[model samples]
Target chain A: MTAVRPPEADLVVADTAVQPSAPPVPPAATAVRPRARPRPAAPRRILMKGNEAMAEAAIRAGCDAYFGYPITPQAELLEWMARRMPEEGRAFVQAESELGAINMAYGAAAAGARVLVSSSSPGISLMAEAMSYMAGAEVPVVLINVMRGGPGLGSIGPSQADYFQAVKGHGHGDYRTPVLAPSSINEAVELVADAFELAERYRTPVMILVDGILGQAMEPVSASFRMPERRGAEWVLGGADGRPPRVVKSLHLKPEALEQHNLDLQAKFGRIEAREVRWAGERLDDADLVIVAYGTSARVARTAVARAREAGLAVGLFRPITLWPFPTAALADLAARVRGFLVVELSAGQMVEDVRLAVSGRRPVTFRGRMGGMVPTPGEVVDAIRELDGLAAGGSR
Target chain B: MERSVIFAGFGGQGILFAGKVLARAAMDEGLEVFWIPSYGPEMRGGTASSTVIIGDGPIGSPIVDQADAAVVLNPPSHAKYASHVAPGGLLVVNETLVLEPTGRTDITELRIPCTRLARDAGDDSLVSVVALGALVGRLRLVRVESARQAIRDTVGMKRPQVLAADLAAFASGYRVGSRTHGPSPDQEIVRTRVHHRVGVPR
Candidate 1:
């Protein structure tokens, strides 16, 4: 890893970050449960909001239980589930708090059920401890964070400021959770289904990070999914009736034991990084400038790119479908081919650091973004791209 | 061609519902559609607005800085969105609520007494449908037959009477729109490049 400055200078790094005592076990070997294939269903064209689509997608994925607290931008999701979960003969609970919701998720996941829990930024912060515990226990649960502005009871508007909070480890310990960000409603639906699949495959928690705008916007989507069965059934608590009782805990009393656990977690994460990286590249064959973005910001980047092309500028977009893996290799390759980079986002500059690290001094990378509920329009992105092009022209001369 | 429209009115004017109806109609016509509401505190008993984009291909942005057409239902809405209409674009004004004419002579402006027309049509709740009819009538952006079918699919099943009133109001507005002439230039100057699909790139 490159010597990069942490987002916060005084940030604390867990003591067990470096020590590894256990051998890496392959994820496939760890995953012994076979999932049921989803049968194709109808309702091929429906105009649904992003939040409602996510809720319906989860149901179609054969989610056994759903626990969530009502918060703006995502209130419709819980409401939809409350109306349909029971109809589908599944369990739905409106937990008293986000903390309660995630803990319930942990309980259901430990018992080997396809579980889903969702919340916004502030609510997500409340579940940090539970997330850490889930990560430590190696439980497979899917969480959806429809991000809004933040720092302290921020406005209920679209934002991506939680990038670091999601990818840089939300809770304590030296562990990472796979994070997927979707730019469109259809992509959000597909990613939510894949999140369950991935969580079970790695036997770890996975998060789908989306913005408030995407959650509130409506578009036409074809709802189709094959439900994923309860993962890790062989070793789950409830499924252990005939076998020895299985215990799930994250507390490692001894330093060596905890270090071994950390090493094993790192190995699983490494495998995920190598095998689960996903991204989309556009018009990169012969482009002088590339814009890096994810989630809703990528949509604006595409609009900006079209306008820039109309103005005779060679600009393309590199969107990371999987934010945790950061699509570092694809970015590095693009960095070598392009003249410079511009990272556009809805946060001050959280993800830009990752882009810079990925480029690793091979090319110059700049950033343009907004925060605290403000969104950058396509016109603004076009202006930023023009400025980057000017810098590239100046450097080449 | 891509058509970006803005519908603005008071909280209970059914502005959002009208946008949804248009989106459904566009979808039925096999066009790409994106609908986004101005989800702010103002939506509570205050002015409400939504942006709907219809295109022959995938839409890039759900929100637009300027709209190709603006349908204003109230005076405040007209004041807020009148200037946002693109040059040489179309502006549909509900004259019963917004009596003042937009001073811009560069674009085509259609004035319809939607509230009065709805009252005359026997259901005041059909004002938005009247405005919708006028919008579809003028632009022909989506087929009128498709919009009629969308109305049936959306609210027709629940309230057959409301659907009947809405069809009558739509027919009145369509007549007014057909004879009123089309937008002056009939196209927006800022064209959206249609090479890339929404999330899936071709």
Candidate 2:
């Protein structure tokens, strides 16, 4: 409408500038994904690695496209998709970079296709830019971050350090992507499917944030999934057919207009938070101490809870399945009754802050974490619970 | 019944494959199973290890700090994981590679010449599978037939000879394991539990 050129105009100009000598490189010029031959039939139950389970679950849920780069801990996921997508007649691209993968996902989502992209820690960081753009454009894209330790290319082991990066809006502006963390392979399968459905329901990006340990771990999963109804084609970009042109964009440059966009995003986030907070509470009815954790850490915390209970200690676990919404209300309710909280994580202390905020000075919340790819043992978590149990009745210091 | 088994050796020992076989066998028996391989540098011609947890109920943690049983194929693995085995746990050692004593008085230690047995069985690559057979055969953690089925599942049609070699290696280890030790105490409990829950024969 204004004189400002749309982002797609640059792509059009670049396309026109390309000489015939270089017949436009194939869409996925950089190493197309591997294609898998069709198998005889699906097994009723199969032993699957966590990453492969997530990929298979997404495909079973009728994911229309997959675009991803190779990253540790989640490389198997991309490999699985690369092989299976062609067989399923879905688009698959092994993008040149994490940015390229996310942008491909954005394009597919804008075209009204169910899209998925996966990467590990540093790769997820690289994808934050496109994630921001997709968020602003209100694209329903499902992303999977099989998290490894990192500030930079850290270790290729499990870590929950990306908690803030995932839940606190990694991209610019006040936008939040719903983040789901699954503690087990079966949960990963179910949650990944749910992630796609939720993304479509909210028309916002959703992330299935799992730790590297969960990604590489092989476990048995039934991997049952129901295909979500494809989203209506009203907002899709295609032939105009004499109707008004649909411009899928995120450039709200005007100050008041940007303010309105932010408000709308906030409203959507508010609805998601109110409707979609998912968590699991174990032994909380008479818990003296609660260990707050998610993903792989939550699995360890469950073991720790069992150990503590065996030792006649009143320790329980509060595992938030959805990290973005944070399950603040559930923790708040538990805080009113429990003696204290011990937030155990694989990072130095990412989710601990969320647990603290959830408590809001209502009870003591102690933090214990392992970092740089170190996984916390059940003993460590039990020790932390004991330390939290010893703390005088007061809020987190 | 929950059983945590750690398979440890150098790279190229088929440590992860052995764990996967055990995991598949456990799952086939209707038990929840988890297998986690040591990733990164430790897996590339270094001291590689994997933890497999099999249980009747849902497994809590895939990472096993202390194992209910351990199959140590090399000296470094024996040194690293021997002490981590719980009291009364099974410790299957590959005597061909690990000559030293584990120096632990708390657990059942069965030393097997894995490399020798695997070679006699027709391939050295079956060392881990041999050790796995020893572990499962001695402890009765998983049924031998189910384990063979798992071997079939994991080692499919591509390399049929390798599968045959693995089965032979497993049978040799099972014979040696059965001859060396009586059925483990845990076997009775597992048998009853499996029968009561899944109606599976022990």
Candidate 3:
């Protein structure tokens, strides 16, 4: 690893300082254009692995600095940043550890720079304390967790075991992080920009939760993105020239003051929950059963839904793009119409709890999950759906 | 239409690279593609494999339980993946490394001396490329021209000599693959011997 200066000394001016006064920005186009047209003006679609694509997307989204510690599955993202950040004249630091990396990110975000940090399961655990501090201090930072099998040092395979840890809160605080779960590489590329915007909008941490499969899989993605307008924030810890000093901290020793701060945070979270709920549904207009999943499991369940439809089963798919808000209202609406739900995940049962809560016993919410990094094949999931359909046909809900 | 293939070999045999080339070719053809590698503790000299799925519409799962085709470069891989091919699918085996014949008669098996062909093509490290050539040549899943363009795009313009050798190996394997009708006479004989020893009909 290359040595570098400390985080404090390496802080550069925010992205606005380096960018042109008014760079002509293109409109965002997330879909991959077909090659049949062969139009010279059209943006080209390039094949890229998910990790490399997310890194490039972050840079294009005007990320000013990146701090990370290399870990399996997601090490590629750090490696890409290490090479590209320097070329863009941005700060890139391979910190001594996950703790150091998160702190470095906290420092950069404090300086009003668009900051990003990424890791897998265990590394995220190490950064939990700093994440809580950042949330309490209300610093905007983007994090990517390419999840792998875990409890301890589990195998390096794709898993959704961290669903509860991420959306429910990984740190010890009454705080919520906006979590975006993308099912494909193209979506992941698009969500990287959204993560930054959401983090800055709410002045809190935002997470892009994915798994090893998305991190390693290669797919075609559009190479163009709309450049975000960067503006200086009044609360940034830049030297308060000609004014009273500004301090950024999370400590509130006084009991009433701490209670008030917690209440304010809860209000902010409530607003986010009302505004930022995102999800996708397919063939739910006239279906009795809907499969609810996200990330890799959603991808597989999509195929199962298609196969079930072909077999004359009225099966639909509901995928939660934002796992935090959980899309409770939408699911509850479906529960009134649909007979039941089948929640599939790579963990034994994490996201299913949220699905059950959404249904609230109005509909039978069954779960089919695989543990220890093993993903359920589409055939297996289809079989599970078939069995559920049979039970529903027998009025056994 | 959708098709999936598995490329399996030892870690140093460029298994992942081979799958990537096929995936790139499929993408260039405007087909949706997903390439996933088995990233585990298996390092150099250990088992390594990658799965590539191509479809006209959105691809669902990156993992494949039954593939339309498979290319196995070593005996261990053959033992593991030979039966994973769907019926009426194709199996490309590196006969130079995998000596035993796959006894199953359901799928079409093309036994090509991939290592020997790579050696004859001027570099022995091109074994994966050779296997890839045989797969595409026999299956025609992706156009040959698209595969060539994918190679150029992936190998880069900086390395001319390496590109030429890889193209040569691919061409050699393609020639052998297109010429073979079905199971070779030698494989038929081996199958007959095994069946007779086990008191089974051919």
Candidate 4:
């Protein structure tokens, strides 16, 4: 260890010294990195982008179909499914519009089949119409959004500006699309599968939130699943024999009927909230400072936690894979054990407010984040964590 | 441990293809692999670069802020990325394509005349393949046999003459790397504990 003795302590030692010469100091130890560690049991190993991995994961989750359009970034995912889906004897629909795509997803869902649709910024804007209809009609579909830099027609970089659009509802209605924000290519797969499971359990639409960078970035994955058994006629649409045709239309003219329909959708949302709220915690059990972050920023936050640990501070990350079904219950659960909660994100303190609301005044929830396309570094997040002791990150700078 | 290598050259020099072959070799050796191309619009026609990450464990970020080793196929590429290579990292440069030399005091730089070697092999098209051979020769990031297999897998049954030239080209490049840098001193020395990633939906 390299030590710098304080001058006061040095004076004390020198003043009291009538001492003999000390033994020779030993050489500094080289950072000892241990030898080969064993591999984890059952590792996933395929090189894929977040969007493609999410699609593959959706397929493995027994999603029988996919519908999409040609868009940069997210196009890789559609291409992947277009090649593989048919070989597995599954339906891969290149719907004309985002609306057409989600409707295909909705039609598949009404028959109790797993289905998905993916699009980028502009295309997702088109999906609002169908998504609202899906929400009102009480159908389950997995919608993947690989967000590009955007407002009207924007650049092709990654951005998280669509958080509100996804959660508050893209489709204008008194309903919500259960949203998931996956952090890595690896998590995109599993979380997308979970979205399918959650959607089915609650009978509502689910969206896998993503961005262009995450869509294009490649990573190794080893996830696998057995090909689902083929379903015959009577399972879904495009069948030879129809016992009774099912209507997927969403029109109720009666005011009472519309109110009842809204009530039913709200009931489903209640069930979703009660049943699903996903979160991940690390170093948090003994942490003096806890940070909440999600999506790609959450991965960076985890890296921050590792660095903070090395700096002799107890810092932890709470990553939400499921953004809504907001995981409020889980946040309430996490709040019971911690003193301070700091929210970090790629957005300007939007989701942090949610974490604060979930904490409900139990503990101070501070937020440190950037807006637009800026990414917070691991070092920057560590400084934020360290400052929590003196409320250095309280409210705002 | 994660190792990153950036392969850079003019677009016509098969820079992206070089990165792909490196990734294929790593995948063949059963290691975690990631290959990413430069995402900006400058990918049009000028100098191009791609980052390749290989590890025994799952790779972290696909975006590399710094690289462990680098192979510069052109002079501009050498100028752009030489400073980014970490100390003790190997830098393989193409003498034929890169005209000027920048010396790194702490890093090892290997010079291979990939284009001349491709000409020597009787084909100039195999220059990148020749560079790939040099990387295998020096880094031994994967085995020569594994790389050859990857070449075979990627090429399939193209022009037999080109196939023969590529094999010779890869072999010559591999010899250069092997003779110069030798095997990585820490070959599998720092082992990474692989974790179960995630399950795919079927």
Candidate numbers, best DockQ first, in rank order: 3, 1, 2, 4
List the candidate 4 regions with Cα displacement exceeding 4 Å.
A1-44, A56-65, A86-90, A107-113, A226-247, A336-344, A360-380, A383-397, B27-30, B42-44, B56-58, B103-106, B118-149, B154-164, B181-202
DockQ of each: 0.22, 0.20, 0.28, 0.11
Model 3, position A296: C-alpha lDDT score = 89
User: How high is each candidate's TM-score?
Assistant: 0.88, 0.88, 0.90, 0.77
Which candidate number would show the highest DockQ if scored against the true structure? 3
The sequence of per-residue lDDT tens digits that candidate 4 reaches over residues A1-397 is: 2121111111111111111121212212232122232244334245466666776667666778898888875787898788768766899999888778877777777776778889988889988988888877767788889987667656666677777788888877698878888666666766676677666666678898886767876765544432334334233344436366655557989999999988887887787777666666555667767878877676567656766777787776677767787878767877887778878766666787788889998888777776545567667777887777557345334
Please list the residue runs of candidate 3 whose C-alpha ends up more than 4 Å from where it truly belongs after superposition. A1-43, B184-202
TM-score leaderboard ranking: 3, 1, 2, 4
Which of candidates 2 and 4 reaches a greater DockQ? 2
Each model's lDDT comes to 0.80, 0.79, 0.83, 0.69
For model 3, how does the per-residue alpha-carbon lDDT over B1-202 read when each residue is reduced to its tens digit?
Answer: 4689999998878799899899988887767789999988786888899999988666787778789999999999999999999999899999889999899899999988788777766678889998888788888878778888788877755466588777777776666566566765565454333223322111
Between prediction 1 and prediction 2, the one with superior DockQ is 1
- Candidates 1 and 4 compared by DockQ, better number: 1
DockQ of 2: 0.20
Residue-level lDDT tens digits of model 1 in B36-120: 9988778455889999988765467665877888999999999999999999888988888998889998888888777877776
> Which structure among the candidates has the greatest TM-score?
3
Cα lDDT of model 2 by residue, B130-179, tens digit: 88877877777778888898899678644665777888778777766665
Rate residue B132 of model 2 by lDDT. Answer: 85
